[model samples]
Target: MQLSFLNLASNNLSGKVPDCWARWPYIVGVNLGNNHFTRILQTSMSSLPLLEMLNLRNNSFSGNLPSFLKNGSSLVSLDLGENQFSGMIPSWVGQSLSNLKILVLRSNKFSGPIPHQICNMSVLQILDLAHNELTGYVPKCVNHLSAMLVINNSLESYIYFPVSGGQLLVEPLLLKERVYDYSSNLGLITSIDFSNNELSGEIPTELTGLKRLHFLNLSNNHFIGQIPQNIGNMESLETMDFSRNHLTGTQIQSFEASSFVGNYDLYGPPLNNSCSSNSSSNKEEVHHVKGINWFFVSMAFGFIVGFWAVVGPLLYSSSWRYAYFQFIDRMWYKLQYRCYW
Candidate 1:
């Protein structure tokens, strides 16, 4: 029977998504995750031109990404994590599906550079490309993610049925290190997970511009260099993991050892390694402080000597001291007489 929503998740269902889905022209949501399905996804998926959400996580779907998704302009959430899908993530992902807000491809065999063209998806908020063999530096254009740069508390990413005018079924979101179904508050979640890959290079400083980002995971990679100096600028960050990489820096606040474990070059609080530079710098500062103290002492001594030199002869000579006091007293009496008269 034709349906607008189909959910067969966590079942014994196997093999490819049925060819019958093509007949469901009104289909808006499809979930077949956690199954034993194998082999290639049918190109018939192109038949459902209005398909909005597709979940194939924890399946055995293999081979290169099917270009059939190019026709799925209405797609907003696509999850293919924990699969065997290989090959580069298509550039068309950002070119065609501009409305997509959530994209997950974790634990896949996909490799090659993450296309900078994907930065074109201004509305994409949650992106998980971890647990892959992907190599190359992260795209510096990450600041282009406009949706993640702002706090969204609405349900703008929800799927809606065209005919009924009612909201469609909710989709699963992997957030805060777990999977949860987000129904009415999907827009509030913003995160990026690119850990456990061969991705190398410095973490882009531009990523700190994602002020509304709530979670970030860049652990278990080949990243080098210090963590971005302004990483604390991500004020909305609630959870982050940068462990098992080659990162070098002092311990970041609000993070624990697990977040930086396996990173030998990093030091400071939360890590057993102390920053020896801190001690040496303190010693140098002590010498500078001592020099400043002696300079102040010399200024005070010179002022005292100069003051006594000018007044010592007047005090020793009784006649000069009497004359000086008499002059001061005469001036004071004259000023008082002028005021009273």
Candidate 2:
């Protein structure tokens, strides 16, 4: 009998994945999640080239990522979250799993900076690495995620693998702040979750370019600096979380106060703290007032000096004053005659 699907989830199955299952060449999806599966996966992996979806979440899988992941280049969705898996996320992930549209490694012991090579996943639409021990800056090259940047109208966008019974499912993803089941409308949903880690640095402004992205979570981390001012450009963003960080800025009108809580340094509307009215404005006002006072005093002094100079001269020389009046009267009459003509 040819087998194409297996669901051994929530069974408390112990020990490594069975070696016998490798002989099933037609198998496309495997679910061993919610089990006590432990120890290293054996060489049976090389036998399953057609495997597309693998879920080993909520397990005791330990040590480095399996090389079979590299072997399974045909994979479209992979979930290893909620595992005891340690060590850095392999660079080979980007190199081998280039076809991956959804990748989740949250709630693991994985550490170190995210590899820049991850930008190579041009079709990757959902990435969740929250609740890990990861450190270092969020890779700025993440702007290279083309799938999130452009709208995918293709009918083949949803993740599904053919099975004897039906297509095997990709489970609903639980992010740090939200749970998204992109099963029906996968192509229309794009999100990135890097919250609850040791990740530090300014949230990259480049992320605003993902105009089709619907959700983003960078909360519960050490990220510093103001939220990107152009974040409003992410028109598709329906959910976002930047809480429990050092983020400081004016509150964006698009998001509610809950989206930015735990950021003690941040001040704006939606939060109780108003933007501080600083002394700079007062100082400027004082300086302007002083300048205007000085200008008026200078103008008044000039008027008095000019009046005294001309009037004193006129008083001392009646002939000059009389000549000046005669000249003014002749010019006024000549101007009126020209206007009448």
Candidate 3:
């Protein structure tokens, strides 16, 4: 048969996938999620050399990392989340699937430290291991995932592959009780979720280097120590959760300037609030005081000019002074004659 894509998700289908995968050499995408599919046969992947997307989530598939995936060098997005899979997250995923952009194994029973080898995927953008039994510190080599470092607003986030007649798209995923549209913003999103685990140790400072990461969740763990001091370097963060942990870090994760309210010692690019906001207010206050002083000065000058305009003539002009006194005397004489009559 000539097949390029097979999507049997959310069908309530049960039973193991047939061992006939080797029969389709042109297959590029296979999704068997949200079903009762039990297991991935060990040798079933030798045939689909062109497979790029494999989503086996929300199923009863249980076992160590599938051996067949080690040879899936062309795979780009692998989501085995919400499965019964257990065992150490294998290293071959990084050794072989070097082109992967999305890797999610959340809601599984997998245990053990995240393999440093997984950092080999330079283009990886989304990594979710939440709601698992995994333990161990996050590998410091995470900065090696180069795609999470810089924000590529152009053609990088549109990660899709053109198959024989159509396209294989990645759906959205949920992390920390929230889900994002899987495909539209896939390439533009850089996230990491390791919440609800047994992991401990200081968070690697290297994580601060991912200057464009959008979401981060490390809640419900045994972590201690302050957050990385250089975290100010990550400027593109949006949603961050570090609750329910042993973290003594100021737990400061805000983009608002008010987050630095009492820090008279803080200084840097974005922290220049005192210079921008306060200086503007101070200038306005000084301008208002200057206006009030000028008004009072002008009023006093007007009062002096008016008083002098009337009194100066009476004081300096002899004829005008004599006329003023003669008018007063005539008014007094008329009042006396009226009284006598």
For this target, which candidate reaches the highest TM-score against the unseen true structure?
Answer: 2
lDDT of 3: 0.80
Where does the lowest 10-residue lDDT sum fall in candidate 3?
259-268
Report model 1's TM-score to 2 decimal places: 0.75
The lDDT for every candidate, in the order shown, is 0.82, 0.82, 0.80
Score candidate 2 by lDDT. 0.82
Mind giving the per-residue lDDT tens digits that candidate 3 earns over 209-326? 9998888888788777766888878888787666666554243535444433333333333455444555566588889999999999999999999999989999999999999999
Runs of candidate 1 exceeding 4 Å displacement: 154-184, 277-341
What's the distance in Å from true for residue 40, model 3? 1.8
What residue runs in model 3 are displaced by over 4 Å at the alpha carbon? 164-168, 253-341
RMSD per model, one decimal? 21.9, 21.7, 19.9
Which tens-of-lDDT digit does each residue in 112-188 have in candidate 2? 99988899998898899988999999899888998888666676656556663445466676754556676666656
Q: In every candidate, how many clashes are there?
A: 0, 0, 3
- Model 2 bad stretches (over 4 Å): 164-168, 176-180, 277-341
Per-model TM-score, in order, reads: 0.75, 0.77, 0.72
